[model samples]
Target chain A: MLRLFKNKFFLLLLITVFIFILMGVTAKQNSKLNWFSNTINVIFSPVEKFFSGIGDKIGSGLSYFGDVKEVKKENAKLKSDIDKLEKDTADLERYKQENDRLREALNLKNQFNQYDSIGGNVIAKDPGNWFDIFTVDAGTKDGVGNNYPVIAGSGLVGRVLNAGFISSKIMTIIDVDSTVSGMLTKTGDQVIIKGDLSLKEQGLCRMDYIPTDEDISVGDSVVTSGIGGYYPKGIFIGKIKEIRQTNNEFTRYAIIEPVVDFKRLEEVFILKNKNVGNTGTDGAGK
Target chain B: MKARNIVFAVSIFIIVVLQTTVLHYIKIFGITPNIMVVVVIGIALLFGNTQGAIAGFILGFCQDITFGKMLGFYALAGLYLGLVVGIVNKRLYRENILVIIFFTFISTIVYELSVYLVHEWGMHLFSPENSNNLDILYAVRNITLPEAIYNSIISVPIYALMIRINDRFENANKSIRKY
Candidate 1:
């Protein structure tokens, strides 16, 4: 039996089968294997700090280039003119649709003013191709907790999947296994946006369970429904890119392109939603 | 043995730190000039295979920690590359800087290619939905020729630097032997 198994063909086949089994078992339970993640992060913090120094230099260099006399003068003049126009427009359209969105956010803030907002920069991205997790500079020290909603100016970034002493890992909305109840901005049709993390283009999230008869159209905007308790209502989620009614389900599904450009994510606000439930499924995939 | 091992460990620590941090800033197409690769190749040329494999695995693990990618990906790749280079070292008599640079370049590709193949294979069997249809062949195309050429160009000076460091160790060893 030993000699029979010693054949190169058999050995290769055995190894191949073993590796396949291993990958399958591992991927299925990868969330449970969060043992080394913190240790790895701790070891790599110095490296991240080093790169941050270089980032500062590059940022300063760009700022210096922008401060050239010709460019600076032009920018200042453009800014003043735009400021004047913005002030006039603000007064004329103070109660119009433009202010409505801001007002809604202000009202939401007033309602949930108990939790302080902590701002942090996205430090490093997950080095692997599959994991859509990124690290932020602030953590427990700044009162950041697991499940805190992270958002950029455009829309939802993700939620704090895990938090460390001085850093936190955000599992972005683009990650696989992520789901958010979203409403069509124009028609108010409710659908759940499912993150297809397997896709290469990160912004792709699918709107599922929409009735086939719903008046959903291409280019319709989607926003959080606020039913999930994780996100505030009317926050932009994405725009419908495609709609398909397959035989597998009664509801038509549409792919959404997220409003946030996750690739270039820098700074973000961590919103402390009081209604977020105690879902034990924090950072380690639990 | 203790002092020499410490020196090797220190050198590897410095190389891995520099590779992920400073060199990352100058990255072109995610291919940073890997000084750790040059160091392992240099050691294989000088001290042979067993030591080479050990060094490669250790440094590769350090790299995995810094990169924060799927764990053990680079470690396994480096181990295989080190063994192959060690086997080739037995039949080769060339040790010029340019020749070493070429060896480093080829080994760097080997290391990267091995990791890429592993990742592709992992994704295919684990998550078919995420798998790219072309597999390794597609990954090879994405790497492009220019990135490899850039790695080769940077490998020359970095390889020279490692050789100098090795020479200093050898000189110190010889003086200690006399004492």
Candidate 2:
């Protein structure tokens, strides 16, 4: 064993294996428990948040011309109204966004009245097309913790993965690892809403365990059933886009398109509900 | 040695930020290249097994801290990848760009698969619905393959940066010896 330690290859393997074992055992705990991971989050979260700010600016800057073209196109569509409403159009557009935000806040506040929320800017995201996971600027200082339900606008975004001092990692609903208990709003059918890696690009998920006689169909809305105690009841999950009935017939599932557009998401809300148990969310390595 | 360590640490830090912030916006075939993989491959190919393993571990750990909740899966994958690639490159010459691209591509695939196996499929037995819908082929086609090509594309510039940094370290060592 002593001689084997001298072999650099074996030494590296031993070191990695030990760390992996330690991590695997603690994977379910508060992620901030690891000092090293916490320190990294502290150091990088701000830096990431800073870059994300710049990223948002740069994205808007680059798309400025596209926005202009859109305005021009809309101007043509409402040419008669444009003559009288041209100046107000700009203010109207601005108000439209503000109104949308206020409406979202109002809806979120009303729906999750029992839960308190800490709003944060989305600082960083997974590099890949899949929004299975991403990072946010808020952390433990903001009272966010593991498995806290996250929301954007009116839709269910995801849950908190790691809540650091200055930042938190969010696992988006469209990720393969996330599984939420959902109910079909119209028919009250219970099903499992899960992130499907296959449908990730389309910003969709798969609904599992749909009974053949649940009176479910395309366009049925799905919301959190609150069975797991991690997420509260009645969080809007998504709307069903399609259904896939397998040969087993027992393995029926539906494709759900998440309302939260992973592409344009810039900010999100982290819910701090008092009555919830500790649950863990983890994402795959890219 | 301290300065070299700082250089590696700083580069990985910047790469992690870019991976999450800037790289998030840029996508090819609906996926962004694994930039950290390119950086690790570059370090491994240029710096030897020791530095490669350490760099990979740090990079992987940072990635986990930034983008994931589970801490050490990526760290272990990175450490092993660095070691594997670093040792493998000992037999090949870095003068050939093709060799780096090929090896980097393979390394990226291995790393992606390791994550999928450890993180995704580890709980495969519990989710029977997912068990029947095997997605290895889908994952390979959609994620790993596109990422391999993307990593290779970025590996060229990372290789140049590695060569320059490696030379600087060697020159600094030489100057110290002369003094």
Candidate 3:
């Protein structure tokens, strides 16, 4: 035993087994970070946040010079868009008043009105290409918890995987491990929005298990079905770009162009329900 | 020895911070070079198997804690990578640029393959869906191959830096021993 203990190869083998054991222990979905990892994350969060800010500044500064010509064209386009939007705003105001009246008469709660949202800056991204996980500069101290839905300016970003003291890890919907129950905005048909290994490279996701007889078509919008409880209902997911038939012939999957520009994403909002435990049941429960 | 260890720890921390923050902007075709692989191989070649393995473990642990769903996947991969590189390079010339580049390219592929195998096939830890749904050919063609090429290209400068740091420490240690 002593001879084996002194063997370098033996020691390496032992360490490998130990790490495998550790992996098994922590691989569960509900596993919490050990105190050591939690402490390290707390210490590193501020440094990461600082460096991320500097990186963003440098990126924007470099892009500003290259964007001069494009900006001029965009400015004109935006002016025209603004003129069109001004006319639509009046019609939207009347609709908003009617919507408010109908909601009060029906005694129905607003889809997202019951939640309080906190903004977070993305501090870092996963260094590898396999996963679409990123860290946000908000945590338990800021009331951000696990499974909270995250969104960018345009649409749903993902959900929190783990929350530490000063930071949290978010697994974006484009990750292969991620799956969200989604619904078609037009046909009210249910589909599963999943992160595909191949499709994620194009900054897109796959919507599978589409209903066969539905009037779903390209350019139709998909939103959260709110079935799995990780996300609230009616949050915009993406627009279907292409529909591909599977080998089974009965099933089909559509490519989704997500609204969130994940490549340039800098800030996000985490939705926290004002009344705790009201968002839905825990994911494991479902 | 203690001072050298401290330097290694600090450098590893700095590399990780830069990797996650600034490295995102420099990605080519959505693939970021795995500098951690290059650093581990360099440390193993410059130092010994023990030092290489320790460095790899530390770097992997940091990544696992920050970015991984599970704790030990990267840590285990890194440890084996460092140990294998350090042991295999014992009889080879370490200073040759071509040899370093070759090793970097090979090690990056090995590292990524092991990660994919474990995450996608072996454990099925992260992906809740069936593993068959994942296309391995796509992963190799798009992710592993490009990453290996990128890491090899960047290894020249990084290996040079590692050599300089190793020389400084060696000289400091020699003077201390004389004293």
Candidate 4:
């Protein structure tokens, strides 16, 4: 039996079978991946970071070189735009103070109150292109953990799948395995927003199980319902692009066009779990 | 342990990094050709099974951490991909572009089928959102076929580079022997 196992073909077959079963075992949702099993991420984080930095520079620098005069003109326009934004910022600040005073007077919590987040630059991506899994430079070392919500300027990007000591993998909203509890902002009608590979090319998702009678339609805003303890309520998910009636029991689905531009994604903010009680709200640094 | 081994390992690392980083920005018709697959097949064909298996196993394991929902999902598929592709070792000339194209096309088909099968199986075992939604035929038509065609076109250059690498190392070894 030992000799039989020693044969290469037999050994390969055994190993393959073992891994196939192991795949099922490991397929279920887990909180954190062991760092020991994922030392490769640790080993390659810096190199990936360096290359990503260069890639970002190259992408931007090329456009700058194409037309220096255009950049100069844009620079002048941006400077004036910044001056205008400064005025807008001051007005918004005054409103924020007034709003805060009213909330405090009424003893009401700020509806815009959200968890504190630490930002990280996207260093590497999942080699396979079908799904939008990627890695970030931040990790447990940077106060991020598994299931922490990842976001960009426009909206929800994804959540941390697992955290290594120095790096973590993020499963984007459009990954086929990702399912988030979602509801329409306009109608409050709930639906399950999950990743579908077919629609992933367009950076879109399939929102399923909508009621036939539900008045859901194109352009409805979807956000996290916070039904699942994983993601907090009201994180902007995406807007519906198209709706289709499925033959399944629930019968209706919609396509979500994510607000985050996943194709050009370079940096992301990972929100700390809100229940931890340190809602500092400073999320715009490194 | 040898310099050639070091070169081979570094090549894998570089290819992986390139696949994830630069390749993310490069897509045609929203399909990104998997360069790692082509590289692994080329390595397996050139280097034979033990090296091929080890390379495939490590690459697959890393890929699991990268893209898989579970730990060993991509690892098992990658391991088998290398092993199966390695079986046709040294039979075809390394320099032949036609051989690279044929092997990449076939290997990609096999790889995609395995992904679909394992994905469906896993969804069956561990409850997917709607297990009925895991359609294998739909995946093949939409995802696999286009990727296979793209990889076949992309494999030619990677295999050519692999051939160049093999030649360079062999020549260096010959020079050392002469000394």
Measured by DockQ, the strongest candidate is 3
Task: List model 4 lDDT by residue over B40-112, tens digit each.
Answer: 7888888875666777787777778655667777777777788778777554576677878888888887897
DockQ of each: 0.17, 0.63, 0.77, 0.59
Steric clash pairs (candidate 2): none
Top candidate when judged by lDDT against the true structure: 3
Instruction: Rank candidates by TM-score, best first.
Output: 3, 2, 4, 1
Please give the CA lDDT of all the candidate structures.
0.64, 0.77, 0.85, 0.76
Give me candidate 4's TM-score against the actual structure: 0.85
Instruction: Give the DockQ-based CAPRI class for model 4.
Output: medium
Q: Which pairs in model 1 have colliding backbones?
A: A161-A283, A281-A286
Residue B52, candidate 2: C-alpha displacement in angstroms: 1.3
Best by TM-score: 3
Chain A vs. native, model 2, TM-score: 0.80
CAPRI grade of model 3: medium
* DockQ ranking from best candidate downward: 3, 2, 4, 1
Q: Arrange candidates by lDDT, highest first: which order?
A: 3, 2, 4, 1
Model 1 chain B: weakest 10-residue lDDT segment is B138-147
Q: Tens digits of per-residue lDDT for model 3 on B56-91? A: 899999998889888888888888899889999983
lDDT of the structure predicted as candidate 3:
0.85
Q: After TM-score superposition, what is the CA distance of residue B117 in candidate 2 from its true location, in Å?
A: 1.9
TM-score list, all predictions: 0.68, 0.86, 0.91, 0.85
Chain B TM-score against the true chain B, candidate 4: 0.90
The model with the greater DockQ, 1 or 3, is 3
